[model samples]
Target chain A: MQDLLLYISLIAAITYLGFKAYTIFFKKEKSCGNGSCGCD
Target chain B: MKKLKVALIGNPNVGKTTLFNRLCGVNQKTGNYPGVTVDKKQGNFTHLSHSIDVIDLPGFDSIYPKSLDEELVVDFLKENSGNSDVDKLLFIADGTNIKKNLYLLSQIKDLGYDIVLAINMMDVAKRKGILIDKEAIAEEFGVHVVKISARKGQGVDELKSAILLESPEMKTDKLIYLKPENHGVLMNYVKECVSENPYKAFLNITQENRIPEINVKKWKTEEAILRYQYVRKIIDKTIKIDKSLASDATTRIDRILLHKVFGYVIFMFVLLVIFQSVFSLSAYPMDLIDQFFSWLSGTLSSTLPPGSFSDLITQGLIPGIGGVIIFVPQIVILFLFFALLDESGYMNRIIFLMDRLMQKVGMSGKSVIPLISSFACAVPAIMATRTIENKRERLITIMVAPLLTCSARLPVYTILIGLLVPDQFYYGISLQALVLLAMYLLGIFTSAIAALVFKYIIKNKYKSFFITEMPSYLVPSFKNVMLTIWENTKSFVWSAGKIIVAASIILYVLATNGGEKFDKAETHIMTEFAQLPDSKKDAMVSTYQLENSYLGNLGKTIEPAIIPLGYDWKIGIALISSIAAREVFVGTMAIIYNIDSDEEMKITQRLDSEINANTGERTFNFATCISLLLFYAFSLQCMSTIAVTYKETKSFKWTSVQFLYMTILAYVVSLIAYQMLS
Candidate 1:
């Protein structure tokens, strides 16, 4: 039972991290309009 | 037939790299600037049918540098006069912050180079209601102005075309010329030889005014106030801003985030979250790596015959090298967050908020980044200290940096803490997490105290001022984060793996063969234990033989001294071997116990069952665990740190002193902990 619980928690954590990695790559915002954004 | 050399210069966080990468398309190499640790990048690409090489110089606000790193960039562009390979300069300017960005552009332009301006981040300007007329800017400056968004790869073609077609123009008659005596007559000589145009005189004047020499010092004394006055006048005429648009947004955000009272509270909260994520989020990948290595060792041992080569592969190479590689995931994760925080421009605000308090602790606000990065690993942190120019200040920062609990010490701390500290909560915080937090706090406080002490003792003839560019905040890019993680993790794993594998093989040989003396003692000890119960007798013989071996004799010699610190002879042996790298402590313990056991069990269980002969007590008790923790926390355990220090300081004496001081400090601290706890 302890092993099962550990495995479940591990899977959940991996899934959340995967979501974060995905969003970091895919998320898009409008180009900063003011040359001020410093994103050359 | 000549190749054009162009430098891309801009303020930090101004998408300079994004543009460089866009143009060069992965044809880039990264290294350090000559004689300094600042990151240097260079790349080449063919644009507008002309092959051009772009040098991405470290970002700075002015040509007059206040730090060693900034001086490197400025000196490279100005002092290398005979190297007329640079055909033109592409000055990247952030359109929204045109007034501040132009501060650097104007300085570069006055050097009398064929110049073109890449007004980048046009997308951001539109959103912020900033209107810029490209034609008007071009006409006023008498230089080509191209709009670009490097991140989106906008206007790059035009930028490339402009560079190919650009040519030097004759200077205007009204250009100012100041022939100050101390302006290094060498620069004037070079300028005259290089250019037969009117701008040569103007270039000489700008060079004389900017470069620091004996004569320029006197000129600065007389016209000190006029420098900024000139800057202001130029800014007022070239840039126009609507004052009504400057609102309380930045201040309002700073109120809650940088509030004197809440600032520390928020910092602690955020730091806690980062720590938790580093441990919790990385646990799965770490476990997977651990399991994979164990399986590989078992499979290789089973497949090969019982011979020296098989033993070396399974016992020496796989477990030894794999143990160090397993921690790569955690190190990469930690650096990923650091890079994200740095790229998003939030790191500058952290420096600004902590500046006053850090100054009181005898460190500049800039010292915070290097010190904080030490948590991930100290090698890069030590390298990062190059940004600090004051020799005394840099040395002090380097001295205390190792006190911060680095990721290399994490495995040891986690094992010891799990065995000792409970998991219960105190005021909604995990007890284990609080203990971890306390350990981190201890490192920080010790470092600060050491810095304060060093500040008063070390006297040097150098002056330092804290000036940093505050970049606007933006979301971090995933591509950059992944690339940084991959590069850092690959280097760390490869370097640490080689050392661990070679050390493991040598350790295995020493443990296995002790010459004729060990063989004779082992036979006698086995005969003496022959009458006892089989299991008990086996354990006694194994322990006896180990104590009589060469490694055992070395451990025994130091055992008497370390006993007061709660370590048994065997633990002393492990500690001595771990000086090569702290992660080896667990692996050494595993190997020692594995040789003794009849049935192969988990390394943790084997260590848990071992007992000390003298006290008839567990070797890893609360007092012993805490002592070990304090030792690893303060000691310079990695040889890589020493190598990096030697490279940075360029002296063996400094590195040796750093190692000696840290080792001595670790010993004293551990001794006190064991005595008090016991």
Candidate 2:
């Protein structure tokens, strides 16, 4: 059960970072300032 | 509603922005003007059944283009010259500098545009006992002159009404034409090229536009000389300065402030104060922020059912983001100081005074504002490079700006200084404060050297002109300063908050989950410490898990590369993660070391007690800390700055050159520091 949770958390974290990267670089949106931050 | 287009054009420091802010209020939008990198502000408002679209053009010195940025302004003007769509040119002139301001107006007048002279800073003029005969000047120029104090909300409605009520039929041929005695060839060429408007022909008689190069230079020089000679004559007749009503306050103060020897000393002292304030005064708020995050993490860890979700928030996310958000106070303070300098008009004086010295280093006096602003953050500082007309100097300023110890690096410095550097007093100064100031000075010195190198390397054929206007010093406006601080602080938080939060969670995952050894963290620590207390046992488990995790192995992989810098695997991890931002170094260290510890200690205490696995020596020793500092000082660490550079230059090639150069410089410098210290 513990191992499953750890894997889930890791995947979630990585997915979040990937989303951020996509917004910052690929979307070419102003992800840094004015609350856009590319997190979407 | 149909819209009418008009541009607000002026010399620098003429309150054009103030009037634009008033006209647009919350209705302004910024967009690039065609192909130029210069973003022009477009605003809209309804006045008396008319929807007005106002385009505030960047300030330029003269009609004759000196820089590409200035050329864009002329290009916009020339395109709109005979076009009926562009309604009017609202020429803003400084009341105090009527003559020089009028020179630009005179050039515009010669261009045969329907122009209105909006004389700003009338309040300042009135106080100085300098009175302008507006009607007389208007009659002389054959243009409508509206006296206004744009800053004080006085005569603004009148000016707006003047723009709104202005008819298309009012043509001003108000400029005095100069047919200099020696320039007969230029006059004849002007006569041959332009059949309709002789004024337009002479004004724009460029070498490419049907004139010889030699004749063009002679004609241009004569034109400027003639304009100034005409301006002097106008000033003599119309403007009056009452010496009794106003003492020469700015000049009297400038003598001590701008003294050749004293000026540099004063500048150094000002920098020393700013650094000291940042390091010493920010302790209280920084501590509160640190403690709050620690508590939040502790509460989440205890309350969230002892699962991965709990660990993720407590260990991975909170520490990661809390590290960056904590530095907001310092960032605000830094920007506030800069705003004060600018509003007080001392910023322009600094540029004026520093121009000669800066030229020696391949930077302009204009680069000073951007470079100084970099001490807070580099994104806006690079944006501020637009004011620098020289492309090569602007690029160099943008490239070297990050070397200045920004607010992000402040966290890294403060933490290390607290941990490794003792709170000893040296010559009546706190030793830590001295070290912080020294780091800042090092950044400045290195940036100077880098500019010198790039001066020769960066190829440019366009002439670099650094002529700057010296504005009279005034009391810093509290309202304007606060507005500036609020806007800048918002941008910093929004941008930094996103990266810090996302990176934290990701780093947390990297540190938390690992292969076989990490999975057996409890078993390994439990067996090794059977008699140890539960608290101690838990700490041992965290330490063990981190040492055995995927992150731990990854750190070990990079250890060899960073070993010469006196950094252990743990430091290597922090170093790698901190490439996202310099401040992330502290939080990465915090999350790795502070987990499961009962006592809510600061990251500084944890780093101080952290021992290296190989040698059993303390990891954050004097040598290691200094090496890390040197690396961060020279590194291209902030992704946002590199992104901004790419955006500004619109070239990946220049961006890569900047990144590679800074990284190489950081590595070499850090290696040297570690070798010398360790």
Candidate 3:
């Protein structure tokens, strides 16, 4: 049960991480300069 | 109804933005025209039951744009010319500085633009005892004159009514006429070249480099000299002012504010107050937020069914997000002060005061504005360098703009200062506040040196001139300040949230579990501490767990590279992770240190209590703290700033130069600081 919970947490974290990476690199935010890559 | 497009044109600091805010209220959005760095703000509002689209053109001395922003403004205007969408032009000017602003007004008039001259700051002008013959000026310029205080909302309704008076056909049929310094000499020549607005033809001729034109006059002329002479004649006839009162209250304020000896002293005092206030005022709310997050983390750990998933939520996500959110108080406060200074009309005075000192280091007074803005963030600050027309100076400004300590460094600084610097008063000021001020000062000092270095190395031939106007000081508007604070706070939260949350989850997953090596190490630690107290044994186990975890292995691999600077593997991990974004350092440190019980144990407390396994001494001593501070102070840990530099310069060469020099400087300086202190 402990190992199962750990695996579930890992999956959830990796999914969120994937989404974050996609937004940061692939998505273009309107504001360019505060901290995000200057794609505005 | 489709909005009627109107261009609100003006000189700098003439309340055009104030009028724009009044007209558009909350219905506006900021944008940039394609391929230009200049910010374009377009908004919609109802004026006399007709929906209006207002676009603000950047301020410039002459229509012949010397800077990129000015060039874009010209392009935007020409792009919208004669289009039914853009039918009216509102020319805004400081009523007192009508003489100076008339040069642009004359050019617009010569282009046969249907315009209403919105003379702002009339209330301030009236107080100073300056008077304008509105009827006479209106008759002289062949345009409607609206004397409205945009801040007070006086006579804006009349201005809206006048916008409708101009027939729509004038927008399309306007002829451009070129009025030379001596119109008598160029009349015959002008008659032959007459087209729809000969001045438009003149603009096309002179600005061929911008508008792309065929053969036209290769005219090298002081067109403004002629226009100014025309403006003088008009002012001489239609404007009246008492000569003695002309200097106004600004001169009186300048007497002390611009004094050579006291100016620097006063400036330092102001900075001390701003920093001190930021530290003190934010303590309560920041404490509440911190404590709440702590309780939340603790509650989750106890309430959730005992498992790794519960541990992940309690130990990782809550603390990681809290690490970044705790500094929001300071960010909001710093920006509030900046906005207040700007609205109070004192920021320009700061630039003026710093101009001479700045020029000694190869920066213009204009560079000061960008540098000041850099305190909030580098990307926008770097973009602010658009006003610096001299290519060399602008490039130098861009290169050193990031050297300033921005809000991203705030969390790192606050945490370090809390651990290293005692919370005591030095001469009635908080010691931590003084240390914070010193960090900002260090940034300015290093940037100056960097600017000086760039001045001699980068070569350029474009002429540089400083032409800043000292607008009359007014009480800052609270509405404006609140709006500014809200906008900046929102931007800071959104941008910082994205990276901090991502890095937290990634670091958590990496830190909690290692491979077979971690399992072996954990079991061995459990066996070794079998006879110890539960608390001590658990502490040892957690320590061992971090040492053998996946993130731990990575940190150990890099520990040798950082050991000389008094950093262990945990600090190494943080230093590595924060390269994603500087603010992530705090979150990285929180997760790596294996902190779970968020009770009253601040990150500062955790860092303060850290002990080296071998030496058994406190890990974050004076030498280590100073070295860490200097490393972060001098390093280019922000990816956004690099992206901006590349985008602006369109050269990886300059970006690499920026990244390398800053990194090399950080490493060398940190090594020296650590070695010296130890």
Candidate 4:
């Protein structure tokens, strides 16, 4: 039971973090740094 | 129709690539120039029914050719002119910084080619309250001028139209000539070539004045100063600007950023922030990559038949290559920051601030750029040393560049620090991060010492000059940063991946298969140890098997030499493999321990269980760990670095000497470290 709880917590935390990163990197407004928008 | 060949020439950081992208439209191919390590990029586009072929020349200050990059550009212009004629020469200039840009433009104008001027970054100039009289300037120089904002796709069409209408006709009929007393014979040749058209006469003068042989003595610093003085006179008349405002603004900014006391403080603060972000921000991506590879290996192992095929997929390729690929995120993050700093023109300030400090250490301020860049990877950083004109200085820069802790060393350092150092904070600074920073400082200090030593040892007869330009600051372009990061990360993963896979497979085979004699010996050891405790019996069998294996024999042979440094045979094997790449040490250790352990165990757990039989002590105790860290810190462990040095120096003797010296340095330093720490 203890091992199962640990696995569940790990998965949940990873999923939350992955979702956050994806949103941050993929957002249209935020993706303005490189040469994308041509504004320096 | 014959393809029109055009050469794009400019001063550095003049929106040359932004213009190239605008004209060529993403259809580009990059390769090494013939017989040189310099990158060659060519792209084709159609403008007004003419097929335009553009060659993006490397950025250079002058055609007099001091450094390798400058020589490459100048040589290409000279050689290509001799072969196929250049249809049109496009000279791009930053509109905001026209004075420095025009110095190169005037030199190109004298080369006698059909020229068109593209005044780029017009938008930035307008915002900065600078007005450029394009028509007036064009009339002054006798060339077609077009205003362009390459980043915004503004005036590109007009620029293309102007290129379509280029003519090899001089705007002025009067010729201007410089009659230096030293060039008596060359002046006679120039006089013979002069005619009614001054542009033609100038071209003829330059052609006749060209030295057939590379007489370094013929060109001196005085000549360069004289040439620049002539250029300054031209700019004083042609260019009309509010110099007071520009100089005042630059001075105000320089006071804070270039301040002797505050400059280093700010640089350290920024560097600390960048390092912290590299570790903390890249962690999520690194973890994901690690987990993905672990799942992939597990899936392949379970699905494939239990044979060499599965072994190749799971143990040999995935684990080995994946370890390298996981570091790509960190490398990209680091490069992203570097590109931003460069594009925004802040890098010039860094050079200016560090010039005095570098001079004290027997290196010019220009060496600072290459040294900082070596933190990412030494290959490009070493390539960048071509910008340093002095042969001895360039060679010394390349020699010490690898000492700067590169991104490749990050994984090894992090893992070792995790095992060795406590994760505590001192006055709000992470202890682990401080240690990492200390390693960087050690690299810099060691590189400075090496340069000072070389200054006394190597005798350079030629005089070298240090001259650098500081461009006005602007916000960095996002597109350029992303493109740089994407290209560099792709190259790193691909190049490192290829070697890692092959090395992993070879290591796996050596650990798994001993000869027929070793197979018999392993059975004998297992039978004899059967009556002992299970843990003891398992260790005994592993030890016996390793003794007879190919790697074991090689390690045992080197054991006597490395034993004083507190390394066992396993460490000796790792050291041998690490010569190809330092990161391989961890992966090789993983494979060796995995093959010997009876119960399936994580690599770190198995390593923890490893003990020295002689002392009955933990093998990777504090002393040995410190020794290994110091060895890697000092050694030239990357084969790519040696190969690049050989190519750059064009001599096997220097490369061999460099390898021998670095290896000896690593051994002696590590020996001292182990003894003192133990």
- lDDT by residue (tens digit), candidate 2, B1-678: 656788889987899999899878999999897776888899988877778888899999878776676788887777666668678888999987777788888777766677778999888777666779887777666677889988888887777777765433323443345564644654576567655254566656652456545566656656776677776677788899774565467755666678898977887777667666766677788889888887898788777887776777777778777867787777777777778888988778777777777889888788988897898798879878877767899999988898887878877887777776787777666778778888988998999999999989998765555556556788888999999899877876776676666667667777877999999989988888999998889878877888778788889999999888888888888888877777778778877775535467777777788787776888888888888888888998877788788877878998998899999999999899889987
Error of 3 at B82 (Å): 22
Worst 10 residues of 4 chain B by lDDT: B195-204
Instruction: lDDT winner between 1 and 3, please give it.
Output: 3
Instruction: Supply the TM-score of chain A against the true chain A for every candidate structure.
Output: 0.61, 0.63, 0.61, 0.62
- Sorting all predicted structures by TM-score, with the top scorer first, yields 3, 2, 4, 1
Give the Cα lDDT of each candidate. Answer: 0.71, 0.78, 0.79, 0.73
- For candidate 4, the C-alpha RMSD (Å) to the true structure equals 13.7
**What TM-score would chain B of candidate 1 score versus the native chain B?**
0.69
Q: Write down the C-alpha DockQ for each prediction.
A: 0.02, 0.26, 0.29, 0.02
**Lowest lDDT block of 10, candidate 2 chain B:** B167-176
Give the lDDT ranking, best first: 3, 2, 4, 1
Candidate 3 residues lying further than 4 Å off, grouped into runs, are: A1-40, B1-95, B105-201, B204-247, B529-531, B596-600
Per-residue accuracy of model 3 over B362-468 as CA lDDT, tens digit each: 87898999999899899899878877767888899999999999989888988888888988997899999999999999999999999999989998765455758
Give each candidate's interface RMSD in Å.
Answer: 15.1, 4.9, 4.1, 15.3
| Clashing residue pairs for model 4 | A33-B478, A34-B478, A34-B479, A35-B478, A35-B479, A35-B480, A36-B479
Candidate 1 Cα outliers beyond 4 Å, as residue runs: A1-40, B1-253, B283-285, B423-428
Output the number of the lDDT-best candidate.
Answer: 3
